[model samples]
Target: MGTIELLMQGFAVALSPESIMFALIGAILGTLIGALPGLGPANGVAILIPLAFSLGLSPTSSLILLTSVYAGAMYGGRISSILLNIPGDEPAMMTCLDGYPMALKGKAAEALATSAIASFIGSFIATIGLVILAPILAKFALKFGPAEYFALFALAFATLGGITGKNQFKTLIAAALGLMIATVGIDISSGVQRFTYNSLHLFEGIDFLIAIVGLFAISELFFFLEQHAGDGLKKVALNKLKLTAKDILFVMPASLRGALLGFVSGVLPGAGASLGSFVSYTLEKKVSDKGTFGKGDPRGVAAPEAGNNGAASGALVPMLTLGVPGSGTTAVLLAMLISLNVNPGPMLFQQSPDLVWGVIAALFVGNLVLLLLNIPMVGVFVKLLSIPPKYLMPIVTLIASVGIFSITGSAIDLYFMVGFGIMGYVLRKVEIPLVPVILGMLLGPEMEKNLRHALVLSDGDWTVLWSSGLSIGLWAVAAAGLILPMVFGSILRGKMKRSKDGLVD
Candidate 1:
């Protein structure tokens, strides 16, 4: 069938009563989770995966719900960034540069409204891009051989440093740790234990879901506990909603530019939404500023929101097309798909066209839902800002604990989760990036398998890894990924820190 007809059928599936209901639920839940400080979309999605499974939703329905949550979380992230000068997630960090300033100047309503509009526009543009680009990319990925696949995985690892732009060494360390973790369990080729240490639990390898919850959700709990002392949110007054059409018109060009830039960033492996938001804000600040860009410019609020949201949509391109995630949240979602026995990649469209198109159509629907929901519900989310960690942490803990336990019913898994949580907390304390580790865990085995397969095909000829044009090109990109970050990381980090200095409290 043609892409258009497939999309029409996808809409039919997405618009089903059950799909719509779950989409709504995901949208609402995701926003609330994103509005909460430090939870982000990755954690929001991780914490809810068990819920989706326990509820017995079909794979398509579960994906629809989760993808809706992903979109909503992207929208919701701007809330704390604007009102509290505390980003709900890393991608939202850029929003705080001007969003909090606008809020401080009694333009909170305008900032929120502008960001919501920009987010919708960005996501809408990205969804269109996904509709156009994903299939083409998937078809291209069909040309990939084992060597090319190995090179692609290397490219993912090489570029992962862009997510943090802090320290490539630390990122590599985290990724190495994850790869080591991935080595646990029996080796598929040898059918012999590699790192199980004679334990049956380790025989199956560390469950990525357990690791995801531990690293993102459980560790977040520990971090909150450690940092919660004397950390209080100051209330911001929400002035009357007075966003004029002229105001919207003023930011349109910036929003469009940011969204396009953001989508490109999102499509690149490992660059993700953080890069999208950072570059969008930086570019908009340079080209359009009349010396009012950072002080309280609505365009400042709009640009990053557009950029990050666009990136969120763009990140799905690699995940759906190549089975390689473009961002941390998508990594978690990738794990969810694996857990559900649905492999995502080039064949996914041919094998599960209904699921792929349904997700795309649902994204379109979810964006509309978020636009409508965010505007009227701004006050509610603002109230959520005042909620204490004391009351909130337990619920996150409860949900995570219950969800993980429900999945395996294994006490050993729970103990391992706690161990991983402690490890995550320590890693965060040392300022090592976590996303790369997750990416490594998700991609390591696949990387190893591809490498071994390629070697065997060439009779153990290591040079075969770069024999093909496609493989060579991928290797070149991988080299650029590793080298560019070292050259540019400091400049980007400096710019981000300077922008963050605008925080009032």
Candidate 2:
């Protein structure tokens, strides 16, 4: 059957009463989980995997719920970012950079509304790309080998440079720390401990959830306490939530640009929403008017929101089409698929049309559902800003701690989380960016695995990494990503350098 016919059939399946109900529930739950500081889509989905099975859901139904949560979490993450200056996930990190500034200027409602609209646009673009490009991209991805995968990972790291903070050196240092942390577990190839320190818990290395809670969520509370002296950010005149026609028109192009760019980045493995949003934000900043980016612009909120949702949707392609997980969230999703006896690969479209198409259709429907659900609730989310610090901070901390403990079920994780939170707090004080550290921790091991795989395939010959045209092209792209940022931002370098030295504005 043609793609249209298959999609129509999928929509029929997804639009059923049961599917629609589950989609709504997933959307609500996803947003709630995503909005909660430190607990992101990955944690939300991971927590639900057991519940999905216990509920006796079919594979299609479970995936509908999970993906809805996935999409919803992307939408929900911006809430804490805009209101509280705390990012719920990696992609939301970019949102906080500008969104929080807008909130400080009493435009929290405007920022939230813009983020919702942009998210819709981004998800729409991703759905279109998935419907039209999945097969083609899957076909193209079949050409990838270990060398290409390694190069792709390199490109992911390269693209992340110099965007996190004023000091590239501090950023690299943070990333190296993550890399070292990622190496603490057993070596899969040699079956030898690397840095376990004879502790059984160290055998599994650090749990990603523990780190997220520590670095982003818990650390944030520490900073908030110190900065505010246990007070919330002062909010102002936050009861409005309507977007003007001109505002809509103003952001449409930026949203579209971000969605397209995010989709392209998402198609590649390992380059997920965080990278997509960061790149889109940087590119938009370069093109936008001066003094409007970091100072609080609606377009700033719109661009990253669109890019993040687009990248989140686009990352699913490789998971469903090639059975290769892109981001950590998708990896968790992939695990659930396997556990449910659903194999996702080249044959997924053919063998499981209902499952595949149903999920895709649900994504389309869920985007609309999230839009409707969220747009009306913008004020509700914005009101969260009004909660006083003494009450709200403890609630946030409680939520974060509970979420981490539930995920890990270890007191040790709590200890480590606190340690990392202290470290993160200190790093922020030193103006170090946490983005590089988080990305490095997540992506470094995968890159190392791919690099090792390529070396093994070529009998330990390093040249095998650059043996293919695809690999060469990817290397070129990686090189360009590293060089272009430095090249284009030379004007900002002196200012940033001075900022690091406390010598200039």
lDDT of each: 0.89, 0.77
lDDT of 1: 0.89
- What is candidate 1's lDDT per residue for 19-116, written digit by digit as tens? 88988999988998899878899889988887887777899999999998999899999999998888999889989988988988999999999999
**TM-score, structure 1 vs. true:** 0.97
Model 2 regions more than 4 Å off: 1-118, 162-168, 229-359, 489-505
Task: Give lDDT: candidate 1, residue 72.
Answer: 88
Residue pairs with backbone atoms closer than 3 Å in model 2 (clashes): none
Best by TM-score: 1
Which runs of model 1 end up more than 4 angstroms from their true locations?
A: 229-232
Model 1 deviation from native, Cα RMSD in Å: 1.4
| Residue pair clashes in candidate 1 | none
- Candidate No. with top lDDT: 1
